[model samples]
Target: MDDLFARQDVIKRLLNESRRWAFVGLGDNPEREVHTQARLLQRRGKTIVPVHPSAATVLGEKGYAALADVPGQIDVVGVYRRAEHAGAVVDEAIAAGAGAVWLPLDVIDEAAARRAQEAGLDVVMNRCPAVEWALRR
Candidate 1:
């Protein structure tokens, strides 16, 4: 799992280079970890696009109802959903032509991760963006 899901090089590349991050499951709820993580990355100069059913603005960025609804290029789709729901989000990310899919800490979907990799998208699973960014910094 370390070699596949926790690849340091991939994590560094995504966190270092990806500018646009579409966070799935991020909504108006600030109490959620997704909100906090998005805020953290946003503070670091990354563009955060909230994607949820409500499509409510989060972190001052416009939100999209779904990955397909997001326009332009999406560098990374952060799957903040639960493990069971993560696979579908990863597939959606692939369909949306995202450059990468990041399933934050505790969200593990090996099959989905492999599928994303097969689709030529960098996959980071079972890892926290904030932690990775801090360690790398």
Candidate 2:
């Protein structure tokens, strides 16, 4: 893991500043961590946009089939896919012009992280938004 992955300042800024988050792979499954985290973010006053192939609305937010399909600016792109599939999602996030890309705990992709960083997006890999927010409080 890159040292930047664990930077407290970066985590704090991402959690405290970003308002809109696009959750890729966020399906309608309540049991999934993505669903739980998205709900947590919503409770924190952040807008959550669901991005999935099914495009099924989750948590009452409209869903887009792809990141590019989203109509407005996205502050963060939260990736919930497996590590193997995370790189592609990061690429999409970069292309979508997100302010940051977050790969939750257990999802590690250093190469993709570098790519996102190189594209000027804050990269937070192997971290959980809920946990980060809890620590700040």
Per-residue lDDT of model 2, residues 45-102, tens digit only: 9999999999999999999999999988999999999999999999999999999999
Candidate 2 regions with alpha-carbon error over 4 angstroms:
none
Per-residue alpha-carbon lDDT of candidate 1 for residues 41-133, written as tens digits (9 for 90 to 100): 999999999999999999899999999999999999999998999999999999999999999888999999999999999988889988888
**Which 10 successive residues of model 2 have the least lDDT summed?**
1-10
What is the TM-score (0 to 1) of candidate 1?
Answer: 0.97
Q: What's the TM for model 2?
A: 0.97
Model 2 residue 46 distance off true place after TM-score fit, in angstroms? 0.3
Candidates in order have lDDT scores of 0.93, 0.93
> Residue 131's C-alpha lDDT in candidate 1?
89
